[model samples]
Target: MPPFSRVTVIGLGLIGSSIARGVRAHMTGVGLTGYDADPQVRETAKAIGLCDDVADSAGAAVTDADLVILCVPVGAIGDAAREFAEDLPADAVVSDVGSCKESVVTALREALPGVAIVPAHPVAGTERSGPEAGFAQLFHNRWCILTPPADADPLAVERVAEFWKRLGADIEMMEPAHHDRVLAVTSHLPHLIAYTIVGTASDLEEVTSSEVIKYSAGGFRDFTRIAASDPTMWRDVFLSNREAVLDMLQRFSEDLSALQRAIRWGKGEELFDLFTRTRAVRRSVIEQGQDDAREDFGRAHD
Candidate 1:
């Protein structure tokens, strides 16, 4: 049985459109509705036939939905939820694709006091934005972490999990704060580092912008891909999860300083051991099917 017969996505960006496409591909009987704050985005979604109906307002979009997924930035989740709170069906299950769970849980609870909120983070995506960037396969084999509140309805949580599973995701349950801390180490910190590295390179006085681009190596290129992610979304993520992100950042800085000291003192054994352990970690990630094991990360050079 399908988890939801009527689904509404309240943002028309990559994630939102991908959900629509995934549903159309996997759950053909389910109805899909979509809306975006930007009129241009809504029009684009309509042009692409991204949803059965493209609503002009958030309230109208979710009126008949059994599942409402907010694909908006983390900073806007509360306002977006509040926008349709009055119009939301009494039995609807509200979920979101926000990276930071603790803040998102607090915001959703505040905005929709009686709603069955199931905050989710589909740990998947690429350095792309807008409806055109979405595809049905984005979530295939990806982890979709669900952080439902302690008081949340059990059936609602299970339905949300099944919904993602139908869309080809593996589901895991987690506490909101723990989800935030874990993601801070795995996703948020890496993005922060990428942004800093790319920005520092751009701002270097000795390196011309054109030269930096022209001489980019594989490592720098990968960092640029991560850094190219949606700025508004990332900005909201960092601010919303500041406490966890800062804790991880502090630990990373200490480790970085230690590495600098080792390099300065020519501690070859220390550096070698660190590199060996990190390499083993990368192999484990590949072994667990988290990434490609092919040479150069499966890149095709034509």
Candidate 2:
């Protein structure tokens, strides 16, 4: 039998819909219910059969859910918890697909004390949003990092871990604070850099609008894709993960300054060394099945 007989998903956006789809594809006996804050999205979910049922209210969705997964922005987890607090079953295991863990763990602990709260980050997504953008295979072959508190129920943790495993995700455990710090560098900083670089290009559009668009074939276009992610979602992610993100930003800023000095001083050795090291990192990622090593750089496959 599956660990969860029924799963309640709050937020019918990309991740939520993808989870629902995966459940249907893999967990044959599990029932899925979903709710989104926006009525239009709720209707859209219903229209496309995004879930077995789309609840009109958040609390209604979690009424009988054995596993309730909050799939909203990290910043809104607290509010979502509060919204479903009264309706959540006393024994229900609550988890979330939030990027940052510390704030989410704190938020859930404070908002829904005594509940089984395990925060997870499914390291999978595209520069897409909305229910229609999701597919059942989105989580397949991706790492799902779980950050459960020390006092958390062992059964609950295992249940959640097995739940994700059934959906084709590799589960890894980590401390909440450590997850925040690690993701701040790997995911958060990259998004910040993407937004900044894309914004700078847009600001200089009057000067290089045509050239920018025309020449943004391979590299610059990928940056644009990352920057084009839902503005509200990214805004909430950066704000909710403020401290860790800021710490990483400071470190990145120092590195950028060093690189600038190296260029100014015509330090070819420094440039080559840094480039070589980063190239090896990319190879490591590819070898570990984290990304495709195709020469086409993600274009041909897509």
Candidate 3:
């Protein structure tokens, strides 16, 4: 109902730190507490004054928190939820910054019966990791998709929406399954392709590879940026969200094969039509201002 006074953030890395900074700057009455499993991240978050208090464990951070955000890797969402489930304040609302919703929702629901769990995916992150990579404006104008269950409390959902809105996110509500399917196409597959191509490039001879790096202009370099993301995080994302990712991957492979056939058969019309359609998609993104000229650099530095 009222604004949360005590907010606990689990996993004080980039996403968590960004939320802390945004809340500190915007949510005046909220008392922010942070916790990270990694000692280094915990120390860094506190050293930089990211939150009012940095706790050593999840339970301590969430004890009195009115809002608790789990910011760990997707696979760890359940464990983090279980760790603090019993200690969560009776009326506390739990949410997350996990990329995939369905899996995270299942994880939290299993661990936190009756606790309000709103799974949120802020579609805005860089390839970078750690608290040092975050900024208050990281979520500005970005989409934050909330996948609240059908019977979730409306007031609880509103409170979580308000929190993200105050942090500069444009909110959208969708079913967890729909959210996962859409993101599988838009995000997961793209990441998979990037990793594949980058791995291909890495296998090239040093002499040729150095030149490839020196000369990469548009598409190749773009893949490199995505490929540069934290390996552990991406690995977990792929393994946990395997079904959706694989379905998209299978479709993408078929499309790639069609493109190969068109090129081999010298079917310029087919190739041109495909390129035209893809270019139009890029144009739409540019029109939305989501694809800035500096997106690659921004992704690299976070």
Candidate 4:
């Protein structure tokens, strides 16, 4: 049996629309409903047939849903849930796809008291937004971390896990706080560094913006891709998970100081060891099937 008969997705962006497509592809019997705060997004979703029904409001969207997944930014989760709280079915399972878990869980719990809340992070996406950017294959090998509260119903958690599994995701259970810290280092910190590096390049007085773009190396080009991610989503992510992000940032700063000293003192051996170890980390990531092993990260050139 399918995990859910009816699934409603709020916020019709990349992740939201992808979930709609995944359900259509993998669960033909499932009823998919979608809604977004923007009228243009709703119209676009309807035009694309992204869902069985595209409701005009959040409340109307979840009125009959057995599962409602909020795909809004982390900072906007509570407001989105609150908008539909009165209309949400008593037995519906509420979840979200925000990167930060602890804050999301707290927000959901507060906004919809007594609802079966199962906070999830898909750990998958691209540097793109809007309904058009979503695809059913986005979660094919991705991790979907579930961070349910201690008192959450076990069945709800299992159903949510099965739902993601049917959508081609691997499921992992984690404590909300631990999930936040782990993601802080693995995902959030990397985006932060990418943004900083790209911004620094743009602000350099010695280099014109045109020169930077025209002579972009592979590393800088990759960083630019990461930096180009949706600013609203990333802004909410950083603020919602500030404690963990700040802690990880401090550690990164300390390590960066060490690297600075190593370079200034002509410590070739130290630099070599660091580079070698980091290269092994990349190989391990590829070996584990988390990334491509092809040259230039599987990029194609004409």
Relative to the unseen true structure, what is the Cα RMSD of model 4?
A: 0.7
Worst 10 residues of 3 by lDDT: 293-302
Candidate 3 runs further than 4 Å off: 205-207, 293-302
What lDDT would each prediction earn against the true structure? 0.95, 0.91, 0.88, 0.95
| Model 4 lDDT, residue 42, Cα | 95
How far out, in Å, is residue 77 in model 3? Answer: 0.7
lDDT of 1 by residue, 170-227 (tens): 9999999999999999999999999999999999988888888988874688899999
Pairs of residues at least 3 apart in sequence or in different chains that clash in candidate 4: none
Ranking of models by lDDT: 4, 1, 2, 3
Instruction: State the local distance difference test value for candidate 1.
Output: 0.95
What's model 2's lDDT at 223?
A: 93
After TM-score superposition, what is the CA distance of residue 13 in candidate 3 from its true location, in Å? 1.2
TM-score of each: 0.99, 0.97, 0.94, 0.99
lDDT of 4 by residue, 1-302 (tens): 89999999999999999999999999999999999999999999999999999998999999999999999999999999999999999999999999999889889989999999999999899999999999999999999999999999999999999999999999999999999999999999999999999999999998998889988874689999999999999999999999999999999999999999999999999999999999999999999999988978899967
